[model samples]
Target: MARENGLQKSLFALLAEAHPEAIVTLQYQYRMNKDIMTISNTLIYDNKLKCASKSVAQRQLDLPHFQQALDSIHGGASCTKQSCWIEQILDPSRKVVFLDTDKMSATEERIMETVVNKAEASIVLQLAEALLLAGVPEERLAVISVYRSQLRLISQSLRGRPGVEIATIDKYQGRDKECVLVSLVRSNETGKTGELLRDWRRINVAFTRAKSKIIIIGSSTTLSTTALFGIFLELMRTNNWIYQLHLGAENEHTIQPPPSPREKRNREHKTHSPAEAILKNRPILRDVYNSSSL
Candidate 1:
């Protein structure tokens, strides 16, 4: 008999109920590396689901060694694996990190009745370009966000860059990538960031897609309001996987809250020189830029 619904509501149960022996569980996950797997595993730990058989490869590749060898070929001697501005996330050893950013200005745009955070697109483009320069093949990288408008902003910069996919999180649900950069576009002091926080399943899928590295860019203060993200942030702190970009000398809290009358006047009077403008948008080399620069 043909069912009206093309998708079964309980396919797994039906399969198990009909023929217990027909279910063959595939436990081996060849997609994500151990570091990415750890993050994914922690998220699902309480679900009590028997998933991702423990036999997944611990090391996907000798990332540090490879980078060193590449640098040597390029006339740079004794290169470290974490050489770029992405030291917090990209490593040959463990490739997972959380980067906290002061919310850059966002222009609110609506698409399909959903609001999109357009501010994050610039940061996302900077990150993708940095990764490309760091020897991650354009073919194996993806930049995913929850909003189509954000993707559109990124697509403008990444246009004609072959093999690099910029898409919404839903498009990436079943897809895998060697490196995945996620733009968590909402960062506000009031904790009014929308469905992105509430959609944990999409977030899970985004985290699990990376085989080698996962770089999550968002505001720590905003994310800390959510339980899942809070735990993840704490874990990153405990493991030293959290990194922050120092946008300016002023406290970051100033970026999140709406400008008061005095602050608005200060901003209106403030002017950035050409060098400062360049520095703000340019990708930084972590090893080169010391804490003083931050």
Candidate 2:
């Protein structure tokens, strides 16, 4: 049957290859918000993908419900100094978020043949619970991971809520959710992202599965060692979408959001000379300028 359709290729791929002129690529995606679609559009589709409509492109999660949920969870303090990072990532306005775990002790461990990161699992669980508390239906949320062991750990923790899908990234192809929480559980000192993440198709699928918001939890220092993820990190940094997870006393944790574009621009205007502003705006030139004596 596989050979009859096309050996090692999907039937659609085979048809598209045979009838190149007849093939029509879909340019407008209705599943993800424009911000959520940026990664896949820039990396996989060469910026060809666009939002189907302004409403779809600008849609965000329910902010009032999210704030209420945070208040209930944090005892009426929705945006405390320690937990402000949570609000920033969960803020209905933010469609794409990267929760960088580089500063935390989120190392991955090999369980016999499979790999799992307990820290990643715990953070995912917390986020899921908070979303559920925020009035997001279980069916509208999903937790995805590339590692089977990591999925298993998250599944076991979230077993009581079976409606919230917790599965491997490959299982989530052609499926989407209102909110998608991704756990990239491969933190280490040597910066190994594993063979699974090297496949751009998987990354594209994982990133483009959310309708309103997509929150990725991972170690930037480790994942940035790779070419694709290095580009992704730079994109996130440039857009000020990366938030660092800081672990405090008594197992307490905090995440601080990067400055907004306006704030960054204002700071630069005040602190930098004209030449410095030019270098600051162009990071590549800034690196070169720093390395040179002049």
Candidate 3:
């Protein structure tokens, strides 16, 4: 009886509920690489979503192009030890990346009612610039955040750099970008993930907007406090897609890989069941599963 809008379900929701067998879900997603689409498919679509074709499913960022751009930006200097991690995470072969800010000195600040994280904004801007320098068309790239304050900060810093759209997740709902950079702007010691992030619909929109590459920048320790994000972080760890930012001496940055698979499995085995149980209890997902059972 919990309706999407306050007191009533949308007509579409009502139809789907009344005629579950008549639901004609679109199973083929042509936009995102399969890896980038997995979270939404699993949580919202019941693992029924598929890539339209092998080419679309397997597409990844163009690494050589990015390297060439980096070389140009660095005056043809080879990638130094400090900058190697950038190259590794931005390597063209990676379609989905979770840049864990848990190890970095990144924290969120409140601006009136909205929130912003300077560290997260800085990292997002750096990566967006790198992507542009790598010859990705300005229009093909986007920076999405869940907070208006974070979006405003990024927009102010990115002034004069036209065409790379910066907006909140809701603004980009029906839109797609070739490369999308998401700034999850909630990081605190108390583990308070706000209500906006707790809503799975917005999270689904944020995850499914990218065509080739999607880079999610957030504090894993902080975000893992939420069940949905906990599952997401677990999946990222299982897939070896997490890259932790390590701040070295004199403020150098490095990307650290997750633990070995054996260690990861052992850790996951201890913490996975609660999130699974929570997911199973979610009403929207329960409806999906019930319809499928029919």
The RMSD of every model to the true structure, in order and in angstroms, is: 15.3, 22.7, 23.7
Taking the candidates one at a time, how many backbone clashes does each contain? 1, 0, 1
Model 3 lDDT tens row, 186-244 = 88999999988998888899999999999999989889999989989988998899998
TM-score of 3: 0.78
Each prediction's Cα lDDT score? 0.65, 0.80, 0.80
Deviation from native of the Cα of residue 273 in model 3, angstroms: 72
How are the candidates ranked when ordered by lDDT, highest leading?
A: 2, 3, 1
- Which candidate do you rate higher for lDDT, 1 or 3? 3
lDDT score of model 2? Answer: 0.80
Query: Would you list the rank order by TM-score, best first?
Result: 3, 2, 1
What is the clash count of model 3? Answer: 1
* Candidate 2 local lDDT, 65-144, one digit each (tens): 87676665565433464555565667787778898887888888988989898988878877787778778888999999
**Model 1: residue 232 alpha-carbon error in angstroms:** 2.0
